[model samples]
Target: MNKKKWMRKGIALALSAVITAGIAVPPATAEANTGRIIGAIIGGAAAADEMNKQIKYYNTTEEGRQALFQELQEKYGVYYRWDLNSQLDRIFTNLTAAIGSMDATVYDRPYNYFINQQEGFNAFCTLGHNMSVNVGLYSYLSNEDEIAVVLAHEMGHGQKDHPAKGMKRSLGPTILANATGTVLGAIAANIWNGQGLTKPMEWEADNLAFEYISRSPYNPGATAAVWQRVIDLSGNNSANAFDIMSGAADHPSNSSRRDNYAKKLTEMSGGKVTVDDGDVYVNKKRLLTPAPAGGMSSAERAYFVMGNLAAAYRNGHAASAAYADGRTVMLGAQPIISCTDGDTSAAEIAALLNQIK
Candidate 1:
């Protein structure tokens, strides 16, 4: 018999994809309702040991890892889109390198990723460095830096082992500790509705993601600007699957996320860049008076421009004085931003960029 039939298994962990998707997480009320049962099942230290054991088994063993991978592939059919997959590969490679700067463990087991046909804005990095991003991601986010931020967030989940912990926390440790592989597979099949990280866990992943992106060629400002665009496109109450920006039970509010990233960006800059009111300031001087552009509002547009300037700095394109090329503000050959109506003229912003540079 093959290994699949020769050995007994347990669906102790088929994590990452379900929890990170934001498809659904049991609400506070439901969590409260299940608390007693989960608490009883955990039974303190014994349960913790069992849960950790399972996490290790699945995250470290080839069989356990493959089982989880198979489970995910079965659930979400794969889509072969060479263009999207190629883009994802490039981003994934950068993220792997970026994550390594701070988290050496990333090299222990390199990440493996694929594109899932799930037509929504979602992605997940499960146990053992296995991840999948939905094809819909490219449809919603076009900026490579912003998309990199999203992938980094999912990798954040993997780095922290959030999946297995979340699964055990929500499912109750004892439940997994005792279930046979066959039974566990049954459980994993329908696990989408009620398993995921706690609200605090979600916040932790977001913070880690910001750190990862800052180390990359991608601008850290994309971290906050991403949420701003999400709000612009979907508003605060979006119910879309894996839409982490939605003000759902599993995630912080979109505005809260944006503001949090803004704070992080400021900290990363050592207070060199800051957003106040609706404008981005550099060296305590207004860089631009933002005006509504595209589908984004004035404030929303400001963050995008802020991201551009931050990218210019991150990528070392801000070494020269700024100049206006048509409506755009440029630094040497790098285009920093396009001027919008109801905003500072491109020439004036270019002058400010030069001063700030």
Candidate 2:
């Protein structure tokens, strides 16, 4: 087949897979839900234990350490710096001490930190407690507090075993479902199960980072400021369907994250949170303006109203009721870009909206 034909076939296959998986499975019984909850708890513990064992083994061997270092240098071009007197080193040491004071258990882990020469605002923590901060992160940060915020977020990924947990969550359900001899069940299991977990994980990591930073001398407002800066730099006009759908799939919108951190800062300060009197996006769509009576635009409101109705149907509401709700709210509003008036049936529209979810 030609390249274009092969690519078209590939797209078809992927969409087919998604639609097959998107078919709603029967809701689990209450007992099943409870059992699954217990299973998840036990599974989480086992996953954590396994993660720690792996980290310990990796760090204990000279060959393993050398392999890890080589991989970092080769893959990412990161350099290990040992200058204790350097400014970056001094800041790193102070931040490390602050983090250690907050959680001695994590501090005692076989953690390794490195700096990269990359000129981008980025940092990451590996499954084995290895962390790297780019030079651009330091250059961009306004203060030590901001730097601490970035470091703490990366540490949060390690301390919470997010990488391990993500691996488990991604693989466990599909494997189990496949073993039960139901291909459709396996697909649905992976799709529905993994779909909602990622954003929560990011939020959990942020919360963990905040907890650590709050106990240190660093200002907790740095978290909010960092997110605000991200929004300012992104130059994203999020008043569109694609942006909203994409935001829902992965991390929460930058605005939502900034607002969350700002709320935390307010709680820490024992005061009311003052929201910025600027444009605010929700789910990546610029929805609201200044505080007083600010609300979503007609198209944005219609899109979400349709989205919620679709969710209601998926949750076992009557199709008639779901359509009724959609029509009641969305009929008067301007159509969302991806959703236009057509010969499309209610069922087709519901399916499309559910895909957005």
Relative to the true structure, how large is the alpha-carbon lDDT of every model? 0.66, 0.46
> Which candidate should be chosen as best, given lDDT against the real structure?
1
Provide the TM-score for each candidate, comma-separated: 0.74, 0.49
lDDT tens digits, residue span 223-341, model 2: 76565555555533333222211222466776786667766654543341233444322223332232111122332222233223222333343223222134222211322123224
Tell me which residue pairs clash in candidate 1: 9-181
Clashes of each: 1, 0
lDDT of 2: 0.46
After superposition, which runs of candidate 2 have C-alpha atoms over 4 Å from their true positions? 1-66, 79-87, 172-197, 236-248, 272-275, 278-357
Residue 203 displacement in candidate 2 (angstroms): 1.0
Q: After superposition, how far is residue 307 of candidate 1 from its true place, in Å?
A: 3.1
Residue 337 of model 1, lDDT score: 71
Error of 1 at 295 (Å): 5.3
Model 1 stretches astray by more than 4 angstroms? 1-54, 173-196, 237-242, 245-250, 276-278, 290-298, 310-320, 325-328, 331-335, 338-345, 354-357
